[model samples]
Target: MRSMLLRARRLLGALLLAALLAPAGAMAGPCGPYTTGNIPDCEPQQQAPVPYGILETQGWAYYCTGDHPYFWGLSSSYPGDFTWDNSCFSAIENVFPETTPNKFDATFTNWCLSAENIVVTLGCSSQPPPGFGPSCNETGGPVGDPGCPQSNISNHCSSTNPPVCFQTATETCSDGTTYSCTADQGIVWCYKCG
Candidate 1:
């Protein structure tokens, strides 16, 4: 029988090559509990949607990290419009640096997103991306908590209020831990991820 149909076509090609070589942490990321992937230890996040009357008026959130990145400093200095108004920024690698509504799905509260936006800033170009200790700005300023509080309606934002912003509380920063914050003008607000 043609060697039993070539041994059942080599046992169905070794079970589809063992299910495509499994083990990317078993392709974790039904995204549940923010189950990251993409094997960079940066884990895979992926989110995209940033436009709402221009949140905090351009020029990114200036968070920081991505290791040494040449010791930072490249903000055209108080020069607004780093683009986002034209919208289109999610490169999708480690996306859940929290612009809004990740953790796999929580009603995507726009303007990047929130209600516990997991602060990243690992490449530190801007937009909540700084790095290298003190957990890098401890989730981004105004004594951050990044877990989104102040009665999280995605922590209420406002540049002209799409969902309205500013909840600003839960202090104890300067490395004392204790997070959950707000404030965009009183200085880049942030904390809370783990």
Candidate 2:
């Protein structure tokens, strides 16, 4: 009886091993269409292209006390690689001295290609306000104020956009063999006439 039990156990182990290994060979078939020469001619799958063009804006706020106008100096986190264009896209006065005495607040916008850290400096000079010297303050960083509006690039190549139409052409190679090619806005593919 013990010998019979050992034989049965060995048979079950062999059956399980065979079952596991059998599917591996069955799965090894041609994954795509083949040409007349039995060569695989798998068409490359297309992927969603990344949008390289980007337009974004950085926000800033400042407060100055004096009768003189204040000017802003902007700098980027990446100095030479990425820098502000030295011009503010937009500016608005949030607080005025008429409403609040000796206190003022204004917001400014600067444009950048990608997301970057922006630093703003305020400089002011006053002539009439003798006792009250020009005092300037800056408040901004990589990420600007939470209450301010931020800008971003819109996706123009998404599925919602129109499909790209490809142009087909035929060209002869150096050996005088003609090949068919297709090109879209930025990509071109050529295949031999087999």
Best by TM-score: 1
In angstroms, give how far residue 193 of model 1 lies from its true place. 11
lDDT of 2 by residue, 1-194 (tens): 99999999999999999988542213112211112111122112212222222354322233222222211111111111111223433344443221211122344454445543333333322111122211212122111112222122111111213422224344455565444333335443444444
lDDT of 2 at 144: 12
Q: Relative to the true structure, how large is the alpha-carbon lDDT of every model? A: 0.30, 0.30
Per the 3 Å backbone cut-off, how many clashing residue pairs does candidate 1 have?
Answer: 35
Query: Tens digit of lDDT per residue, candidate 1, span 17-130?
Result: 997763223322311122121212232222243343322322223221221111121121111111122232221222233332111111122244432232222211222223
TM-score of 2: 0.20
Q: What are the runs in model 2 whose C-alpha is more than 4 Å off?
A: 1-61, 64-85, 95-104, 125-194
